[model samples]
Target: MLRCHEVTIQVPGRVVCDHLSVVFEAGQVWAVLGRNGAGKSTLIHTLAGLARPAAGSVELQSTDESARGARARARIVGVLLQIEDGTYWGTVAEYVLLGRFPHSHPLMGYSRDDIEHAEAALDALALTTYAGQRFATLSGGERQRVRIAQIIAQRPRLFLLDEPLQHLDLAHQARVLDLIATRAREHGAAAVMVLHEPLWITRSCTHVLVLAGDGTAHCGPADEVLTRERLEHAYGCRLREVDYGAGRSFVPDV
Candidate 1:
């Protein structure tokens, strides 16, 4: 649903990617893998229209993303930043309810449907029990889950998630991945997530983008781009591949 046309992303002194052209289709989950400072987050921000690319352009559903207004863009794109600096003193439910802002009528306030959506999102992330709790009082992982719930409540066509697995335990991480992948498959949504773990890509991702930290990248179906040699080159390390009943797993050879 989203296409990058010869997009070039740079951060300060470093070039993240140059002339990177790729399409993220509906019903697909894409994993963006790169080591630290590789500009993965920068690439995501550029796609979300939160940052400007150095060259080329991005399109959402064939229209120029920059030409769209903020509210118009919000209706189609949901973005989860790697770091959320804003502080919300409201309750968990109230915080998540904000996600429905794009759909809610400003003068009419939140509708019953909006509340239901927020509640369902909270439940999906296993945060229904904490709905009444204060958002500022939650643990790190709980807060991360809440952030994800907020995005789910938005119900946008495209999900741009940066470091989505941050601060979560293994179980929660698995649940989050499954939830995103299932939503993309069932609702015809598209998700581009910045992830550090390659094993999760084997589990849920349909496509992979590997940034080599030198303004070069590889993008293709997960099976084609997630090979041991490519990952080793992109990550600049040796990775040992092991096969299990479920799928393959990669670990540091050292």
Candidate 2:
């Protein structure tokens, strides 16, 4: 499990999220839902260890109390950020191979197992044919797929993805989320992702964490916290939650 205790985050002069606490357990897909500038990305960065919390501690279940939690998180969490600003320099396969850095050796080099894992991840994200293509040359959506493939190659116990479906089309969005869902179940890992699309969250997540302004959360099972009332309260606007079982969807209340 991945947990945050009394976590607070602040920017230069503003307290974005305050005293936030949440737990992500194995066999659960969690959606961190909120509106723009609600500190959703900040929370994800904190959990990923890319940004330090103003005050709080993050813990991984398997580690000792005295163990360095930051280092442990780095090893156990595979993160996908909201943006990829810097240009990538390598091929899709090479970029995916980078995920094995924590386990690779200079002299021994990348093993066959590592190559197989990277290849499998590429295949999973439907980027196999683009394996040899330059990362910088792919379209934005295609690049996002490669990024997801890299994280899949990492095979971490905790997955933190920030707005992972932003640039993806309907088909790729479902495919990618399904891929993450399958991997999390197969490995008994915890998957926590931030999303703006209510329909996707309702359909893809087992647990949902709704973030309101000033750092409040209404978190629970998908069917509970994803209701019209809760979503309107969280996003400060009305919403309509629709159910279609296998093909569930949601729309703006207004």
Candidate 3:
């Protein structure tokens, strides 16, 4: 479990959220929803102990008060940011293998188990063909897939993804999201992703976290929190829900 205790987060010009407390459980997929610049990424960074909160604290499942919390958290938490700098000058395999650093022995080369995990992750993401290719040469979507493969190879207990499908086609989007969900359930891990699409939330997530862009946030089960009104309030737009076969879909009333 990841617990935030009365956390307050703010940006240089805007307050993101104030005194917000929430808990994320294992084996559950949660979607973080908000408009642009609502601090969705900031909140995720804070959860990963990459950013400092204004007043409160984030407690990871591993409560090893002896060692540095951030180091301990990394052993259990996996983070995928929205973008990556193109400065890395290495092959795809080398980049993906970096994820296994937390598990491998220091100063020693990657073990056979680590190599197998990296290979399996590449195979899962269909990136085996690009293993020897330079990371800078891959297209944006391809790079995204490789990063996803890296995190999968890491196999952390919790996954924090920000706009993970930014550069993917429809098929890859579904495939990646499904893969995350399947891996989460199979490993009893947790996923908290920042996404713009409500369709993915409905299909892949069990919980919802909506930042209203007004220094406030709401969270609950997906079914209870993803109503048209809640979405409209979070997005500040008119929306309508329509029955899509047996399920439903939300569209803007414009």
Candidate 4:
């Protein structure tokens, strides 16, 4: 589990994360919901330790107190940012194996277990067929799945994903999101993901953190946070919830 207490992040004249405090509970999926520039991504990065909070701290709750350093933190937390920039040369398997670097023995390279875990992660994401393919050669959705596979191989106690549904077809998006949600639930690892779609958050997340543009948080259960009023308030638009037969969807009235 990860805890953010009274965190504040300032960038020049902007206060991206304003005295924000939240807890990511184990075995639960948390969906961070907000419109663009609402600090969802900033919060994710802060939790991942990529960006230090201007105030307060991010602490990982672990059974073993030994797992408490940067290197140890890498093994305890995995991050899947929206962008995959340095992924041009390595094979899919190699890229995924990089997730094991934090645990690799010095001067020993990757172990047999590391390779097996990497392969299993690829297979879990149905990317085994593309194992030998270079990262640069894969399609957008394929690349996203591959990136997720890498993160899965990390075997972290906590998972942080930013806009994980981006650039993927509906099927792949569902597959990837469902897999993460299921794994987190089964393994008792905490998961925090940023999602643009209200429906995905409703279906996949146990908890929701709705962020408004002015840096206020509406935090609660998924059903409570996914209301039309909350969506309209966070997004600054009128929204209507339409129930058609089996499922419902939210649409902007603007």
On TM-score, the leading prediction is 1
Ranked by lDDT, top first: 1, 3, 4, 2
Candidate with more favorable, higher lDDT: 1 or 3: 1
Tens-place lDDT per residue, model 2, 1-254, is: 87889888886655766787778899899999887887889888888778889998876676545435544445578999888786678899999998766556657988998899999999988999999999999998999988898888988878899988878989999998988788678878889999888778877789998778666776788877777777787778766667777766668767
Candidate maximizing lDDT: 1
lDDT of 1 by residue, 185-243 (tens): 99988999999887899999999999999999999999988889988888899999988
Ranking by TM-score: 1, 3, 4, 2
Off by over 4 Å in 2: 63-73, 245-248
Candidate 2's C-alpha lDDT? 0.82
For candidate 3, the 10 contiguous residues with the lowest summed lDDT are 62-71
| Each prediction's TM-score versus the true structure | 0.96, 0.91, 0.95, 0.94
Please report, in order, the local distance difference test score of every candidate based on alpha carbons. 0.93, 0.82, 0.89, 0.84
Clashes of each: 0, 0, 0, 0
Error of 2 at 150 (Å): 0.2
Cα deviation in Å at residue 180, candidate 1?
0.7
